[model samples]
Every structure is written in C-alpha cells, then in structure tokens.
Target: MTPIRHNASGGSDNDTVLDAVRDCVLAVGVRRTTLTDVARRAAVSRMTLYRRWPDVRSLVGDLMTREWIAVATGAIPAREPGTTARDMLTEGLITAVRAFRAHPLFRKILDVDPELLLPYVLDRRGASQEALLELLSGSLREGHADGSVREGHPERQARSVLLIVQSFTLSLRTMTDEDDPDLASEAFLRELRGILERTLTP
Candidate 1:
C-alpha cells in the first residue's frame, strides 16, 4: 500500500485517478494494459491522462510506487517500546497485511498485477523503500537498545527482515490453495516475525 498523493487537505481527484486505474488493472492486468484503457475508465480525456502521466509504464509505475510507500508507513502505527521485537514485528506486519487486503486498490492489485509490482519492490527506488527502511531501522535500533535484537549491524538486520517479509508475501500470492488469502498473508507475516526474532536473538 503506497501513500496516495494528496494536497494539504485530501480531495477527490487523485483517488479518482487511482480508482480508475485500479478498475482498469483489475479488468486487464498491468502488463497487457494501455493508457487509453485507464483514460477511458477514468472518464478523462487522453490529453488529460498525458498531462497527469507521461506514459503507460510511468502511470502504472507511479501507482505501484506510491502504493508501496503507503503500505509501508500508513497502517502499522508506531508506538512506545513493545515487550519483544518479535511481537512488534508480527503485529506491525499483520496490521499492514490486513490494511492491504482491505484496500480497494490492493484487492484489485493482488489479483492480477503481481509482476508489474515485483520489479518496483526489487528496484526499491521509491518512497516506499525509504519509509520501510526507516521504519525497520528505527524499530531494530530500538530493539537493540532494549536487548531484544542483539547488538549487530542494524541496517543489515533490518534489510534481512524486510527481505523476509517481501519474499514471504510475494510467494504467498502465487499459491492456489483453497485457504483464504487474508489468512495466508497473516501467516506469512507471522513466520517472517519468527525468523526475525530468532535472527535478532541468536
């Protein structure tokens, strides 16, 4: 979930664009999609789409990028120190998953648009990576200070934890199990937290 762009006060236009793009993505996925489709869905002129977005790849890219930042920072509320690093990580990740699962864009996104988003995650160029890195690094440092995460390189530890979460969630998306996607997502987060806890401790 990336932070949706907004002005000083949130308005309707951007969300409008996102909603249109999401519906279009759901209808046609990302790889096979076109700007005209988004424009048509948005009920905006092609010139308007061009003015807002440079091209199809860029438009989709922007959505993926912002959505990621929003996901990384928006839902999982930071707070005072928790009892355990593992607990904090689990709760935070699960909160994020739930939010993503419920998000209109994400619900549509996870269904047909994994590949378009994966590269961006790997690229890690957008605000989402920065926000995620900051959040994880801050949390990890706090854990180290509290003797939850063992004394080590905070950046390395945080990077590993981030990778674990990303890998787990992406892996789960491809599963065809009859189980609920939300439950699968929650389980992925739980396992990620466990892995981080063990690594941080020993």
Candidate 2:
C-alpha cells in the first residue's frame, strides 16, 4: 500500500486516505474497518482523518464516489479517427462496465460490504449518480457535436444511458441459474449494444 501523504489541502491527500480505506476494508471487511484503522494504514493521524470525514460511512461514501468516477472517466476513449461519437459513447460505457466489474476493490466491496453500494443506488441525489451524470453528460455533448448522436439535451440523454448501464452493470452479481456465464454475458451484451445503438444514434 502506498503511504498517504499528509497535506492540508486534502486534494491528492484525499486519495491517499481512500487508498487506506480500501486496504482496510479489503483486509477486515467494512464492519470491522474503522477510521482508526484507516488512519493507521494511511500513516496519518486520527486527527487528520477526522478533520476531513466525520464518520466511517462518510469516508467510505467519498471513497466509493471517487473510485466510480475514476473508473468512468478513465474508461472514456479518445475520439478515434472515423469513429462516430455514438460509437465512442457505446464503447466508453461498455469499457466502464468492464472496468467496474474487473475492479478488485469494487468486487471485494460488493462481496463483503455490499451495503456500501446501497446508498449510492438508492438515493437519487447521491454522489455516485452525480459523478456519473457529469461524466456521461460531457460525453453526450461530444456526441451531439459529432452529429452521430440524436440532437437533444445531453443531460437527458446521459441520464437515460446511465440508468440503463447502471442496471446492467450492477445486475452482474445477481445472475442466477446460468449454465454458461460467458455465453449468457455475451448474449446480454449483444442485445444491450443493439438497443443502445438504436436509441443513441441519429
């Protein structure tokens, strides 16, 4: 684990604490992980941790928001030559889903601390939704300029796409009675891609 640097601004320093939180939660689950443990792992004083986040839930919520935003933003591909914005949006969303699924910390949280995911999904005005909305809205605006995407409010289009992608991505762990998970996943992706392409394309 990278040692967290103590910084007054709490910029990258925040990532350091979040890293420590991830380590603590992975090793001792969410229930057992405490702010004290995070402070120790981060090599920062409890005072430092407390100076920023009031409680463990608040800290973890920030961590989740940061992690999800990182995955979403990082998954956005550069505008490739000859690729339409619609194509880029689809690819970016698919890439984000893959990244979310493959993220070790995210998977561990889902397995051991699933409750951490509830607030983000259940609350309409949660940080997770806001972060995703910002990322998706930016991408939709690019698509609109490229003329590949339907002309509409980018925020509205982004919300529609985010809801669809969130449902599919979060539903991964809930699959039941699958004879071949790979085949099932491929089929699902095929249908999802078709629907998104039709809906998003002009």
Candidate 3:
C-alpha cells in the first residue's frame, strides 16, 4: 500500500486530500462523491486531485487503505515478557474485528456503498488485506519458533485465519440476533476466540 503521506507532525497535502475523501464518503457515500467535491473540501485545485487520483474510486481505495492499516496497527498487541505469539495474534485479530466494525468510515461504507467492497471481497485482495496477511504470516512464524502454534505453512495458515476474520468482520451482522437477550454478537465473538485458539494450538 502507498505509505500514508504524513510526517512526524502529521501534516501533508496527501493527508488533506484523503481526509476530504473520507468526509465526502461519510456525508454522501462513494457513488455520489466526486473529485470536484474532494477538491473543494480539501481546498485544493481540481487539477491537484486529478494529478494524484484519476477518479473517486481510486481516491476512496487509498483512503480505505490508510484507515484499515491504522486500525490494524493499533490493534496489534504490544510485546511483553511472557506473551506467546499465538496469544498475541489471537488478541490482535479480535481487537481488529471490533475496531473495524466500529470505525466510522467502515460503517458508513458498509451501510451506504457496500458494493464498493465487492471487488476486494470477491475478486482480489486489497492492499490493506495484503499488508494484514504479511503481518499474520510473520506472527505465525513466531508462534512456530516458540512451539505455540501447530506446524503448517505459515502463508496458508495466515490465509485461513484471514478468511475467518473476514467472515466475522463482514458477515457477522447477518447471523446476529438483535433481540437476543444473550447478545448473540458478543457470544459469537467468544466462539471466534475459541476457534482461533484451536486453529493455532499445538
């Protein structure tokens, strides 16, 4: 993925453009948002936007990449003295699911322009997904070294875990019961935790 364009102080024209794209998507959805609208919001010339992003979809793709990467980075567990890689990876995946579901941009896109995600979901992996898979595979290798995770191809194991996480993050609402007093979604998350544990356990 294109690295987010911001310095230590967090100010850049690219950041401004992506922020405008985010606000436009949140307010009017992706289909309705235009390059002109983003330019206006960013207070930059339309030529400036066109120079960077050819269309709204590409602009939105970059925005989503930035947001999703941030979410995943924040979700990763901090290393400590005795925490096994399996435990860290499991916690990180659960945290990422919760954060993705709660992200305003993610929620807005899923509600108003879910079709925008169909290409990424059905056809090819997005940049964010590739980055996540890299992280997962590295962690799986760590688990193997520590004798915490079962022996397997780390790449395949990471893909399997990503499939499970994607299902929970994207389709979870379909299987949830709003009226259930037991909080079906939370219960299902617990099930997810168990499933990950068993999947990785030696």
TM-score for each predicted model, relative to the true structure: 0.71, 0.88, 0.92
Pairwise TM-score winner, candidates 1 and 2: 2
Name the 10 consecutive residues with the lowest summed lDDT in model 2: 1-10
Q: Model 2: per-residue lDDT, tens digit, 60-155?
A: 777777777778778878876899878877987888887887888788888888877776678655666776777677767877887888889888
Model 2 clash pairs are none
Give the whole-model CA lDDT for all candidates, comma-separated. Answer: 0.65, 0.78, 0.88
Candidate 1 wrong stretches, greater than 4 Å: 1-12, 77-86, 98-111, 121-127, 173-189
**Residue-level lDDT tens digits of model 1 in 99-122:** 666666666666766666666467
Which wins on lDDT, candidate 1 or candidate 3? Answer: 3
Local accuracy of candidate 3 as per-residue lDDT tens digits, 118-158: 99889999888888888888899999999999999999998
Ranking by lDDT: 3, 2, 1
Candidate 3 RMSD computed on C-alpha atoms after optimal superposition onto the true structure: 3.4
Candidates in order: C-alpha RMSD to true structure: 4.5, 4.9, 3.4
Best by TM-score: 3
Residue 119 in candidate 2, Cα distance off native in Å: 2.2
Model 1 TM-score, all chains together? 0.71
